[model samples]
Target: MPRALAARWYSDHDQYQNERRVIWGSEWLMFGVTAELSRPGHYVADEIAGYPLLVVVDPQGELRGFHNVCPHRAGVIQWPGCGQTGNLVCRYHGWAFSWDGSLKSARDFGDSPTPDDHSLRPIRVETWGPLVFVNLDENAPALASTLGSLDTAVRQHAFTDFAYGRRLVRTLECNWKTYVDNYLEGYHVPLLHPLLNSAVDMKTYSVEVPDDTYCIHRAGQVEGSASAGVWVFRYPNLAINVYSDGMNVERIVPLSSTRTAVVYDYFAQDVSEEKIQSMVEMSNITLDEDQTIAELVQRNLDAGVYEAGPLSPRHENALAWFQGRIRQSTGAR
Candidate 1:
């Protein structure tokens, strides 16, 4: 049996900071969707994990990504969130930049010798299917290299039948790792999520990690009902859960050591109001259940009374695999 990650990993500020540098800093994280960045001036700006990201389509028909910050007094080229911007002008000052992040004009700093070139920092951006991803590390391998078997699993999905749905964001009041640990296992489903437990056959449920990079879940639906069809959780922050007629892509983003945010993007074959409501409600209920248990577990870990416990050899292998990846990345105990 493998032991769960130490309690300190959940509540320690230092451990959390270390993880931000080694894991989140160097990984290819999910951004927005390709459909949003369709037009030439279209852009999506948001703070992903800790990076203030801006991925915009340049006038020359190219997708460009930058840190969204201007080197001149750390001004913002665009405000937070997605929108259609006419030009790359700093929100703080009048300083403007070109699509390639080079300074185009200083507005009124005429002949002042301009402190440095005042360029926006650039980051790597790529797309897999309709999903866009950004990477902070310049030296990290391409998004394809990090995908592992997730590429095949997502590709084999019947996404052509579905249309992109709206995004639902939820914040969890616990350490990010605490929520993630709960996400990587189903041991609590029987107790925490009774509705989910009844919807699938508990006996046939299995979580397998064929590759260390991703985890796949298999279960027999109780009533030919469409639950998450190809439920795959890639290591770290991405989970693609496909159903018979719809699916929700989950992104786990850390806000701080004690807080985490989950972004759910639903896609459905049936875009009707009834179908959309049903899917959203189901996801909300499940998230509510998971959040309740995760937050309580986080509190106990912080209290220092409970150390790490033994993981079930049969059921918690996913948790072990996830924690193992953290151990390797952050060098935590």
Candidate 2:
């Protein structure tokens, strides 16, 4: 049987630092929705892993991304969250940047203009459906290649019909991996989620890792299909779950070694407000259950009384797959 990752990987400060470098720093991360950048000068600014990110639409109607830091004294271009701006001017200082993230003017540093080399560090920005993503790693593979079969599954489900609805941010007092470990398996559903367990046939519930970068979670069968309630969890931190009328995208971001944030953006197609509210309520209910358990588990992991344990061969294969990728990425023993 495979073993769970050692507890050290969850709460250790050094291990967290290593993860920030090797895993998050190099991976393509979902940033925000494309609807937020519908017009030129509209932008979304936030931090992913450890990088302060900025994704904005230029005058040419193209999406561009940057480090969100002013090259001059490292100030922020915009306040966190979504807003429309006339230009990329540093909020702290007045340094201005061009749409391409090139240095345009240095508020009042000198008489001559600063070179483009001092511009905000540009990153890669791309969109899949309504969501936008950024990659800090200049050498990482394209989002399409990284998504692999997840793309096919998404298209098959007609997930592109989802439009940006609403977003919910939940801060949890646990390692991001702790919640992810909980997400990658269905072992606890029967014991913890009575409502969810009764709705889906547990015997048919399974998590399949068809690609190295993503996994598929299936619970029972839809009327005319092989499965229903299918969700996709991409390696490191992105999750996309599809429902009959809507979908929710999850971005599991690390605020620190011990603190994490779960950002949920809900989307729906031709669905009524009542139905959308019901779906969000269900998600919130399940989230509350998982949060309470995950926080308690995190405390135990940090209590220093445990190290590692055997993983469930039947239910936790996805956990093993996830943990193995962490080990491979971070060189953890």
Candidate 3:
């Protein structure tokens, strides 16, 4: 029988810090899609696990990533947003960086030569289909290796052809792991998500851990349903949910030991305003139901009434696999 993670694992600050150092530090994390930076000089700046990152397309039309910090005084180069510009100019010192991460100008330090050795720090970036992923640890395995069968799963679908429809962000008052725990299993669908349960065939639900770092959840489609959405979870915090009409990519960003930020980026075959609005509304209803139960579980973990429990071998193998991976990553007992 698989055992559930202890309650402390969900609420402990020190454990959370350790996880940040080990799991997030070395994992290949999905940032955004390639279409966002499709043109030369296009860029998007954001933070991943507190590490400021910038993704841009060079004059040569190649995707690149950097630390998003100016070398001179550690000033931020670009504010958090997306746009197209020839160079990344630091607002504090007017230092500019080219798309290839070379220092273009250091402005206003006469006779004090610009250090040829200094440039924007580079981060490892890669693309899988239309998605962009960056890894803090350059030594980690290639994104393809980590992705494994996920590539084959998404290949049959028109995922790359889908255009961005809408984005929904939610900050949940629970440990990041709590939300992931809820996401990795289908056991709660019948109890917590009545709408989802009515839509998916739970008896046909099955979970597969394709590799050490990801899980795939498959279930038979309900009668007359258009699609049986594919749910793929990459270790640490990335989820790709694909349906016949669209795809939803979820990033679970840990704000603190007990707080999490979840970003839902929805893309679809059709990008009409009416279709986007309908998709957003349906997604929100499903997410709201999940948020309620995840927060409630966190409250229970904090209350100290329950320390641990046994896993359901039939329904929670994926959760057990995820918890095991966390333990393996952090070397926690």
Candidate 4:
């Protein structure tokens, strides 16, 4: 896919369209890690493509992803978030399911007649490092294969060893793609993020698109200092931003055509608690700036002020590449 075509597609709405039908539909979508669910029967609920989802760890410590809907009465098996429960019970009919999504008990059904096809639909589960991903399409590629060159980048960056520092969610008044576009380029830093401009060297910043699956951007810093930072944009949705002391990674999940909910996690390698607090403060400030600019862009785009925008070869090539990949995935070009 050419950069021009890619940029055009992203601008035209390929991000939301493709994600719902393609990325989240067939490919592996990351949920947290194996450690999050802790005990057997503990479950976390999330949604993708508007379908309710349940992630759980069994007695054997294996993690599984299941449709949160009960097959019997189509009632939701869990709430819209994570929780620990001994058994998944449908609130409507009292159908119970096991940790692995098998039907455990049906409250009201004849002995001869099946209460319902009560089993929960299973989503393919895969684990890498501490992260867990589920493929709604059963035959989709493994998370590692889909990761492409990012597997190496993730390992080299040692994100697996970084402990979770904080998790934050912000609902932004913008299209999800709008926020992603803002993130993919540094063109807005000097203008929208005065604080970030002081922290990151704008002139020395460079983005590397090793393949269609991953894009990495390096932030320039002082020599012989541990101030180097990198941001990895994993194809489709995840953003892995690693700093010297800590790291911040986020996934952009669209709630609607014009609204996005960003799930962010902050991690620290060996930083002190005070430093982590400070990093969190700085991160929030940066995110606030980004959300502000992104919202404005969304408003302008919605108003049709511009049909499309050009990506500068010098500054916006990475965003151009990202847009190109999106076009390729969705057959936009």
Top candidate (lDDT): 2
- Per residue, candidate 1 scores C-alpha lDDT tens digits across 275-303 of 88889998889888888888888888889
Worst 10 residues of 2 by lDDT: 221-230
Error of 4 at 287 (Å): 0.8
The number of residue pairs in model 4 that clash at the backbone is 1
Least accurate 10 contiguous residues by lDDT in model 4: 1-10
Q: Estimate each model's TM-score.
A: 0.95, 0.95, 0.93, 0.89
Off by over 4 Å in 4: 1-18, 111-116, 223-227, 270-273, 331-333
Q: On residues 60-120, what C-alpha lDDT tens digit does candidate 2 reach at each position?
A: 8899888888877888999988888888889997987778777788877767564756878
lDDT of 3 at 282: 78
**lDDT tens digits by residue: candidate 3, 204-246:** 9888887777888899889876446788888878898888888
Winner on lDDT between 1 and 3 is 3
lDDT of 4 by residue, 41-95 (tens): 7788887547678888777877778888778767887888777766678878888
Give the per-residue Cα lDDT of candidate 1 at 233.
83
lDDT of 3: 0.84
lDDT-best of 1 and 2: 2
lDDT of predicted model 2: 0.85
Give the lDDT ranking, best first.
2, 3, 1, 4
lDDT of 4 at 93: 82
